[model samples]
Target: MAPLLLLGLLGLLGLWVLLRARTPAPGWPPGPRPLPLIGNLHLLRVSQQERSLMELSEQYGPVFTVHMGLQKTVVLTGYEAVREALVGTGQRLADRPPIAIFQLIQGGRAWGQAGSPWPTKPCRSSGAWWTSWSSTELFNIYPRLGALLQLHQPVLRKIEEVRAILRTLLEARRPPAPGPGPVHSYVDALLQQGQGGDPDGLFGEDNVVACVLDMVMAGTETTSATLQWAALLMGRHPHVQGRVQEELDRVLGPGRPPRPEDQRSLPYTNAVLHEVQRFITLLPHVPRCTAADTRLGGYLLPKGTPVVPLLSSVLLDKTQWETPHQFNPGHFLDAQGHFVKREAFLPFSAGRRVCVGESLARTELFLLFAGLLYRFRLLPPPGLSPGGLDTRPAPAFTMRPPAQVLCAVPRPRTLACSLKTDGPSPGP
Candidate 1:
């Protein structure tokens, strides 16, 4: 009876060892100890993951590992570590973690129906990106069962909604024939890639949904959010606003849309735009997993380990920026007052995983920002001093400026030309 009891206890201990997650490798970056399953989640604040990671970097050095549930992530903070991982050995970290949800959704089907009708007008594109950990959690359960019992109901619904729109767009964009036909858009390029034959079925409706969603987010939310930050910053710092406006007036003038080429001529305006992107720190980063077993920042990161190149850290590093905490356009300006590029200004991120729409984003930002400042003098709402405008970041998908009203009073150049025999003079 005593022997039987001891054997049973030993069996239970063996099972526990097998079931628990493996401990970190000998050379893996050091991190706070993780419990049986929760990992270092207790060390983090809700919705403040970026800040939490920054704090951890201070304690554990620029590169360190932390377990978020069962997943071990390698966080690269500061300019040197981030640049080394992203730019130095980018190919090693190019692959995105495969999401089973993406593969499971379409179940091996080409999205665009042959010879289908295209929408007469383009559909409004929109989508949302829930935290990756949520998706990672789904991997543990049966995909089908998880779908039925998914906690993120609104996000699941949004996925379907975005997919429906993408399906329509794919049908519209698919070339009648896959070869030498006009590749009108990104969807067309994707369709052409598959036309050659996707043995792995890599280019299909499922991937198309992912690709289109990427475009929607890049083109819409990020661009719009950065512009919102620009406007808010303009309203808050009137001197900065005035300088940008002065540059815009001298260069683009009224009613003339800012051409991409005008970025060269509008130095201060360009500086302000660059500074806005750097200061607001939009879309801190999308985690990229190692494509191959890679060593980063003197640490061995196994393949598929999520690597967060905390762009916000790079943007706010005291060593990198003259005043990382403040919104100063001079960060991009030299003593000569000419526009200069900062090596550490990585708003769009770096490496192969960099934003595809960066040039488009920059162009769009210059056009909209220069156009708005050229046409109007953005001011704080009545009774609010310019200094009173809040610069505190409102947390969201991006570090968005707090919601508030701003008055857009037209500039002198944008005012309509008066008729020779107009009625009464306009009241001041």
Candidate 2:
């Protein structure tokens, strides 16, 4: 009887192994084979996530499948595939995938004893406990004077200082002011809603803080990285750099600061900025999930399938942009030097999840780029050729230019004084 039971158990084990080895449904997107249980999660390295995914797509074609743990992820590469999946299908892929980390943070479930003390207090009622958890005191104050305060610290410290400034500014600007103080800012708009009693009931202090944090995170890092890349690229391609300066000089004179309104007149400068965004493609891929069962390219994707929209592919796809790999501003400009917007240029992403800070980012990029170029001509460090400018990026949560320094030599001195100044410069 024992020998018969052992034989039956062995047969069941064999059947389970056979089922595990069975192929995935036919006509699913082509992809590297996933291992049992671990799937392709182990295959992805943190540092090389973007490059590895790009390589996989190159081998597996524009649209491919990858499994992350038990979850299936569809990678959409190339401009057409990405556009069709993201824009054409629209919100079908708008929802963020249910990742463990996101769920924990956003699920709003409080863990721990329900009616216990704050560790120091006596037992509290359930109502009190719930009120404490939902209290507005949990939210941090917003910083509004971020532009006025200056911090001499590391980047992270500077960011915190800036936030404090923003909070102060917001506080000062609130209520009893002349007409409406600037509603230009996202925070200002939210604060306005809150003051007006928020008919939607969503404009709480927590939401305001989160929204500000989101704006800062999205606006600062990506724009800074892109500007860094632009500086490096300009240093490498001196001719392009020269063209940008020439355009600036011709339109906005050397002595004056470039204004936001000047962007329309400075077409070449605008084109260069656009090219920088396209070439760098900082965010790379924006992850989304299917809201319901849907067919993509004739494949039935089950509801909740993770979709990765590869923005880098859209920016660098050979079929979409001329000289996609090369640093070319002409990609964004016509022969007449008009700024040409491309549908393929989607660094801010698309649909509902499109970057909320696009306007702010664009303004910062233009203002900073124009400001820096106007002040100094970026050159390769002494004794180094343009090729010495590091184009290789150290990819993190965002793609960043490798650490390297460049010489910022002031452009040839012209006038010693202008506007309020008494006299013109003495010629050298």
Candidate 3:
């Protein structure tokens, strides 16, 4: 009886070992011990979540895995790990994980569509979209079931509302007929693509609406948040602000708008923009999934494994920057005072799934930042000294500056004003 009991226990232990081995592929990266069902969710706080992730990297090394709920997530930190997977082995990591929230808001398709009736219009927005991790907890269960059963009722409702708004926009923009029309706008191209059986199947009406909604959301928020940061930073660092205005005054004197061609001559201003992106380093991580079984940073990642390339790690990599934590524009400038681009400057991320609005964002950043600095001398609010101002961003869906007020003192500039146009001046 004793011998039989011992044998039974040994068999059970063996089965347990086999099941544990099957969870992750051999040579899988190390990570924090996750609790069942919850995983590492308890370890995270809503505030400064990226900072918490960065701290975790120190304990587990750059490339490591953590379970969020029941999902196994691989985190790639620093420039080497990020570049290797995103850029060097891009194609294999091109596919995105099926996120429930995106599907709910956008529709069945992920991106652009073809041969649509709607003509694309110019994007106009000053703000960026907000990020939320609430959806992640739902990954443990079926997406539809979780979305329906979970407590995030408002979120689900908002997704539906956004979709409805997008549908209305699509209807409004739809052209009466389709032909060799103006194809410059995004909507036009998407409409054109939806015409026939697209080889990639990316040109459906649903997909087009999703793509347009994404752009609209991006245009409305992220850029605006970034410009807000620029204003705050300029106010805090008056010397830096002075330098930018001096360049503008010299190169783009009085009433002349700064053009794309003027970028070359305004090296310092360009450097400041680059430095601002580096300092802020929004979107701490860019999410990707393995298209096929692949190895990353010496770890075997099986097909469909969710991966997060930690962009913040690269942006603040000690090995890459002279002063990783400091707000220094010299990082983007050479010793000769020329604006130099750095390989580590990846605010919009890299590889195939990189941000599509990068070019537009850059143009907007330069124009907005320069234009503001040209006319206004941003000053720190009363009772707050420049040095005393807090540079830390609020812990939210995106890396946004803390809520505070600043004075945008108008600088005396030639406005090309005509006194005689309206009426006779009042007698003094």
* 1-428: candidate 2 lDDT, tens digit per residue: 99999999998876675466356757678787776544565556544566678889889888789875445689988878887887777667777754332222223322210111011111123442222211111111101121223211122343455557767766775667434466876667878777766776576655554456555555566777788888888888899889889888888875899999999999899999899999887878867889887678767788888889888888888888989888889999888879998998999887666776688789989999998888778777768899876777564446777667777777775322211101111111
RMSD of each: 9.8, 13.9, 10.4
Q: Taking the tens digit of each residue's C-alpha lDDT, what string does model 1 give over 1-428?
A: 99999999988876674456455568889888776455676676544568888999999999998876557778889999999988989589887654444444334333321111111111122322123233323332235555666633434455577678888988877777657777677777788887768888788677766666656644676777788888888878999988887777777665677888988888889999999998878767667789888999777777788887899999988899988988899998889889999999998888786776778888988888888888777877768898897776654445556667777777764443221111111111
Query: Which parts of model 2 have CA positions greater than 4 angstroms off?
Result: 1-23, 42-45, 103-184, 195-201, 414-428
Q: Model 2, residue 32: what's the lDDT?
A: 78
Give the winner by TM-score. Answer: 3
Against the hidden true structure, what lDDT does model 1 obtain? 0.71
- lDDT (0-100) at residue 226 of candidate 3? 81
Candidate 3, residue 377: Cα displacement in angstroms equals 1.4
The runs of at least 3 residues in candidate 1 whose Cα sits more than 4 Å from the true structure, single-residue gaps closed, are: 1-24, 99-149, 169-184, 187-210, 413-428
Each model's backbone clash number? 0, 12, 19
Q: Against the unseen true structure, what C-alpha lDDT does each candidate score? A: 0.71, 0.67, 0.72
TM per prediction? 0.77, 0.73, 0.80
How well does candidate 3 match the true structure, expressed as C-alpha RMSD?
Answer: 10.4
Model 2: residue 207 alpha-carbon error in angstroms: 2.8
